[model samples]
Target: MSSAEKDKSPTKEVDTDELYQKTKDEIRPKLEYLRSVDDYCTSEAYEAISLIRETCKSLGRSKEKISKRVVDFMLEKGLAKLIVKILRSLVKRNDKSAYESRAKTHSVAKILQSNVKSREKKKVRIELVKCGIAYPLLQDLGACDPNTEDPRQRIRIITDLFSLRLLTEYDNPSVIPIYRSAKAVDILMKFAQVEYAIIQVRSLMLLATIVNEEESSRIVASGECILTFVEMLQKAIDSKDHHYLFDIKIDEENEKEFFMTGNRLTEGLNNLASNDANKSAIIQYGGVATLTSILRSQTSKGEKQEAIEALWKLSFVESNVEVILAHLNFDTAALEELKKMKSSDDSKLRDASTGLLHQLEMINIHDEPPEEKGSSDDQCHDPPPSYEETMSGMNVMISYNWDHQERAIQIRDKLKQKGFNVWMDVDKMRGNILKAMADGVEKADAILMCFSRKYKGSACCQAEANYAFKLRKPIIPVKVEQDYDADGWVGIVTGMDMYISAYSDAVMEKNWSQLFGELESIEKKD
Candidate 1:
C-alpha cells in the first residue's frame, strides 16, 4: 500500500483497544490516589472510576477515553454534593433582611428615581401604593417632587422607607404605617417562610387574627399564601413533633375564626372522612399520605391524643370515614395504639376516647331517632338490671319514689344482710346524681322498681326506670301500696309478677324475709 493510501485509511483507526488501555493507565492511578483522600471518598465515584479502569484494561483500550468518562462521573457527583450543601446552609440561615436590603439599595431606588424625575417634569404627584404600605404614607410618597436629578436615589430612599415600615410591622404592631396596603402582609408572610415550621404555624395563626377581614380574604385567595401555610403544617406533622400539635391553643376569641379558616386548608383531610371535594384536595396535596405517616409515628401520649382528635374530626365528614376505618382496620399497629389510648390515665384522653367511641357506636348502629324507636319517656321509665347476686356479693339498685324513702331503706338494709350490694337512691345519690344513677343501673343484674303512686310523680324514679329499659335489663316491679296500679305505669314490666306488701308495722317487720324470697326467685330465673 502507498503512503497516501495508508493515510486515507484513517491511520488504521488507532486501535480502540490500545487507546482505551493507554487512557486507563493514566487515569487509574489518579483515581486511586483521590479515593485514598477521606474528604473525596465516595462509593459511587470510586465504583465509577474502578469500572471504567477495569473495562479499559480488559478491552486494551485507550486511557484517554476511560479518563474522560471517569472525570465526568466524578464532576457530576461532586457538583451534586456541593449544591446540596449550599442549599442546606442557605435554608438554615434564612436571612430575609439581607436580601431585602440589597434589593432596596440597588433595584428599587433606581426605579423610584426615574418615577420621581418623570413626576417632576410633568408636575404630577407620583404615588407608590403597595399592599404593605399605609394609605397616609402612600399619599406622602406620591406627593414627593420628581424634579430632582437623582430621582433614582429618591426611589431608593422610598424603598428603604417601605422596608423599614415592614420591619416595624414585624417588630411592633404600633409602628405599622398608615398605609393599609397588602405589601406589609405580603412581606411578613414571605419572611415567615424562612422561620421554622413551629414559628410559621404561630405566625400564620397570628396573621389570621390580626389581618383585617378584607386583607385576610385577599391573602387566602392567593393560592401561594395558603399553600405555604399548609406546607408548614405538613412539615411539622411530618417531623412527628408532638409538642407542636398540642401547642395549638384555641382561645375563645379566635377559636371560631381559626377553625373556619383552617377548615378550608384541611378540607382534603376532611374529605378523607367524607370522600368529598376535600378528598381530591387531600390526595392532590399529598395530605392523606402525610396523615397516615403521622398516625404511624410512635408519638408521645399528648401527640397521640391530638392525632386522634384530629383524626376524629377528619372522620366526622362522612366521606372520610371509610378512609379512617380502612386505616384502623389495615394498620393493626395503629389500631393497637388507639386501643391502648382508650385506657389512658389522662381524664381528657379518656373523655375524648369515650366521646369518639360513643360517636362510632352511634354511627355503626345507625342511631334511630327517639320517636322512631320509642319516646324518651319510655326510656325514662325502664329500670336497668343489677349485677348477679353471688355468694361473694350481689348488687341491687332500688328505684323507688323518694316519698317511699322509708320503705326503700328498709329493703336496702335487709338486702345488705344477705351479702348483696344494695344501692338505694338515698345512699347512692351523692356526687353527680345522674352519673350515680347510671353507674348503679349499669352495674346491677336485677333492678327492683318499687311501684307506687308517688313513684310516677318522681322524675328521678322515672329516669331510673328509663335507663333500665334502655339497658334491656330484668326489672321486677314490686307494688308497695294497694292503691298503686302497676298496669298504669309507662314501663309496667310484665312476665315478672309484682309482690305487694301492706304498709303496716307487722309487714314492715317481715320485710326482710319477703325481700329475700323475691331476690331468690330473681336469682333462680337467671
Candidate 2:
C-alpha cells in the first residue's frame, strides 16, 4: 500500500470497516431483542450502549461500530415514526402549575457516548442513511403539527434537530430545504425569545449556524432577530444570570453553556451584521447601543470581546458609524476602560481597543455621547422608542396554547395595525422561551388570553394566565373557538363569566373594538 494511503485514519482503512461490520453482525441479534421493547430511554437501552461499546472494544474496532448499531436498532424498530409523534404532542405540556419544573431528562441518544467523536458522529449519520432513518427524521421536521398540538413542540423539534444537523452535512440541499419548509429559520428566531437561559442560548447557537449566509442573515436581521440579541445582552448585563451558575439552581454544566452561548449569540450578531443590509437592520433597530452597553458592562471577558468584535463589524458600515459614536459611553470611565484594554494580553482585544479609540478620535467624540432614539427604520413610522419598545398603544401580551396559534396571530397582527404593542410568540418569539414569557407577562400593561375548545386543558395557557394573576396583570379573554368552555383552572384565572366571541364574521370588528376598549381603559396595578 502507498505510504500516503497508510497515513489515512482508521476510519478510512477498509480493515476497520470489516472489523466494524463483524462487530455489528455479532450485536445485531441482541439489538433486535432490545428494539422489540417499547422505549429506549430505560435500563435496557443504557445496557445496550454499554454492551455495544464493550463488544466493539473486544473486537478492536472503533466506537463508530456502537453508534452505528444504535442507529441501526432505532431504525430497525421504526422508532423514527414514533419520534414524529413525540414532537406533535410535545406542545401540550403541563403549563398550569404555579411552580416551574426544573427537571431535565438525560439524553438517551447521548448514551451512544457523551460527545460522540466527530468520526463516530459521521459514521452514525452514515449508518442512519444506510438504515433509511433520515427520511423519517426529515419527515418529522416538515410535518405540520395539527394546529391543535401544543406550540412548545416546535421548540422541542428544533432543539432535537440540533444534534441531528450537527451529525451530518445538514447544509445539503435535500436536508436544509426540509428545515426551511418546516420554517425552521422562523422557529429558531421564536426559539430565541424563550426565557430559559439554556434553551435561549441553545437556540442562538442553532441560529448562528443558520445565519451564516448573506440572504439568511439579512432575513433574520430584518425581522426580530437582531432585536432579540439586544435583549439577551441587556439581560446578561442586568441579571448576570449565567455568571453565578452555582448561585442559580439550573444545571451545573449549563453555567459554562450559558456563558458560551452568550458569546456564540454575540458572534452570531457580529456575523449577521457583516452584511450591509443586515448591519443597517441592526443599527436601525438600536443594536448599536446594546452592543456598546455590553462593552461597557461588567460582563465576562469573552462576552465583552464579542461585543467588541460586533462593534468592529458594525463600524465597517459607514452609515452605522454615527449611531455607534452617538451611543458610545465616552465618559472618562468608559474611555479609560477602552484605553486600558489597548495593552491587553490578548492580541485580538488589544487591536479592537486601539481601533475603537482611533475611530473615536476621528469622529471627535471626546465627550459623553448623546442618546440616540429608536432605529432609523422605526423613526419613519413612530415616536422615539427604546430597544424593547415597539410601535405602541397598548403593550399587549397575548397568551394562548399552540393549538389556537392561528387565531392568536390574527389578533396579534390586528392589534399591531391598530398601533398596539403586542407580545405574541407567533410573530416574534425569540431567546429563552420561559424567560421571555415571564418578562412579557411582567412588562405588559395587559394580556389577551386567546382560547379555543382545546385551550381549557392547556398548561401553557394556564401558566401564562396564572403568571399574569401573580403579577396582577388583567387578562382579557378573546375566544376564537365556538365550543370552548371555561371551567376548572381556566375559570380560576379568567373568572367564571362570559368573554368576547368571534363566532360570527359580522361581530368580528365590534368584538375586537371592545377588546381594544379593555386594552385602553384597564389601569395597570402594581
Candidate 3:
C-alpha cells in the first residue's frame, strides 16, 4: 500500500460478534457452576468470579458495548445475588483467603465503576442494591486492617478504599441512601479517622458527598468529627513538603487528588460551620487556628478562598469572633495573608478575603467598650440614632435571594406605590451587608421572608432572617420559588408560619395583595 493510503486507513474496530461469542463461552460455565452450587468453596468462587471480572474489564477498556453485553449476560444468570452472597462470606473469613475476598469486593466495585452506558450502569447498581451489596462492602471497609508489614494486605485495603470511594462518586441516587441505611456513613467516618492519609482523604470525600444537614448537625453536636476535619487542614499547613497529608506523587492525577481533598475538607468544615449552634463548637475545637493555617498554606486558591468563607460565616457570631480574635493575636500571619489577598488579582479570592476582613472590622467596631460619660467630647460623640428613630415609618423589610432580586424589587415598587414604606437592598451592598441587613430588619415592623432554594442556601439571607427572628420582628413568609418546600434550618425558622404564594405572575396577581393586607393587620395589631 502507498504511504498515504496506509495513513488514511481507518482504525480497526473490535469485532463485536466474535467478542460476544468468546465472552459467553468464557464465563457461561463458571456462571452455571456458581448458580448450581448452594455451597461452593471460597477459592473456587474467587477463581470463577475473578476470571469473569478480568475478561469483562479488558473488553470494557476498548469498547463499552462489548463489556456491557457481557455484564448483561452475567446479570441474567443472577450474578448480583451470587456475588453479594459470596462477598459476605469471604469478607467474614479471617484466613489466608482474606486478600482474595477483598479482591472480589474490588472486582464488583470496579464493575460498578465501569464506563458502560448509564442505563446499564444504573441497572447493575440497582441489582446490586437489591442483592444487599452495600452491607458486605461496608463491612469489608470497616474491617480493613492496613497491615504495615504485609504489602499485599495493604494493596488490598487500598483497592477496597478506592472502590468504596467510587461508589460514592456514582450518579445513581439509589446508592447513597442505601449506603447511609447500612451504616455506611459511620463506617466511612471511622475509616477517615484512621492514621493513613489516603484512607482519611477517601473517607472524607465519601462523607462530603453523602452527609445531610441532620448528620452534619449531629457531627457538630457531638463535637467529634469537626476537629478531625480541621486537623487535616493543619496537617497540610504543617507539612514542609506538599502532599504530606495525601502522600501523592506530583503527577496530574495526584495533583487533582490534592485539590479535591483540600476542597472537600474545607467544604465539610464549611457545611458544619453553617449551623448556628455549631459555630461556637467549631471555635472551641480550634477550628479558627486550623482554618487560619489553611490561609497560610500552599493550598489551591479555591481551597484558601473556601477557608476564608468559612471564617466569614463564623464571624457572624459574636462569641465566635472573640475566639477568632484570640487566635489572630498569636498567629499574625493568617491576618496578614487575608489582608494581602484583599488585593488579589483573582476576583473571588479578593472579594471573599475583603468580605471577611470587612466582617471582622464590623465585629470589632460593635464590640468596642464605650467611653465614660464624664468628658464633654465623649458626650458630643454620643451613639447615633437607633434604627427605629432614624428609619421611622418603614413598614416591612423585603429580604430575598439575589437570584430573585427582580421579584424583590417588583414587590418593593408595588408597596411603595401604595404608600407603604419598604426596605430592600437594591443597591447591592458589598462588604458591609450584615450591618445593612441588621439596620433594615431593625427599622422595619415586619420582615418579608422570600422563600426559595437559593434563599435557603444563602448565608447572608440566613443571617438576615435569623437576626429578624431574634429581634422578635414578625416574619411574613412569601413563596417565591414554585414547588420548593422549605426544609432544614429554613423550615425550622419559618415554622408553622403561613406562606403567601407569589411564585409567578399569575400567582402574584392573585396573592400578592394578601401581603399588603397582612402588613396592615400587623401594623394595626402593633
lDDT of candidate 1 over 1-526, digit per residue (tens) = 9988987886445665576456547555544554344332244433433443344233222244543443344333342232122222222222444223233222222222232222121111112212222332333233333232333324332343433333232123232333234344553444334323333333344344234433444433433433554564465555433322322323444321112122222322221222122223433344444454544575455545544554554444456666666666777776665655554555344433433444344222123212222322222323332444546345678888665677777777767777777776563322124445667888887788887644543334554676688798777666665543443233345333556463555776766567677677776776
Top candidate (TM-score): 3
TM-score: the better of candidates 1 and 3: 3
C-alpha lDDT of residue 444 in model 3: 81
Q: Which parts of model 1 are misplaced by more than 4 Å? A: 1-201, 207-284, 357-526
Q: Write the per-residue lDDT of candidate 2 for residues 187-212, one digit (tens) a residue.
A: 55554555454444455555444432
Question: Model 2 off-target regions past 4 Å?
Answer: 1-138, 144-155, 161-205, 211-214, 217-222, 243-261, 329-334, 354-526
- lDDT for each residue of candidate 3 in 1-526, tens digit (9 for 90 to 100): 9999999999887699798888899888987877776443467876777776776566546466776787788788887887777777777666666566556646755764565565577677677777777778788767766424344444555566666555544344456667777787787766555655555555655665556555546445555555666666566566664333433343445322223355656765775565565677778788888888887788788888878888878887767777787777678887788877765655457556756776667333233333334322223332322332222265678889877888888887887777777778775553324555666777788888988755764566776787788899998888887745666567777783568888888888898668878887888888
Over 4 Å off, model 3: 1-95, 104-136, 142-176, 185-228, 245-264, 275-278, 326-333, 336-351, 361-492, 496-526
Preferred candidate (lDDT higher): 2 or 3: 3
TM-score of 2: 0.41
TM-scores for the candidates: 0.27, 0.41, 0.53
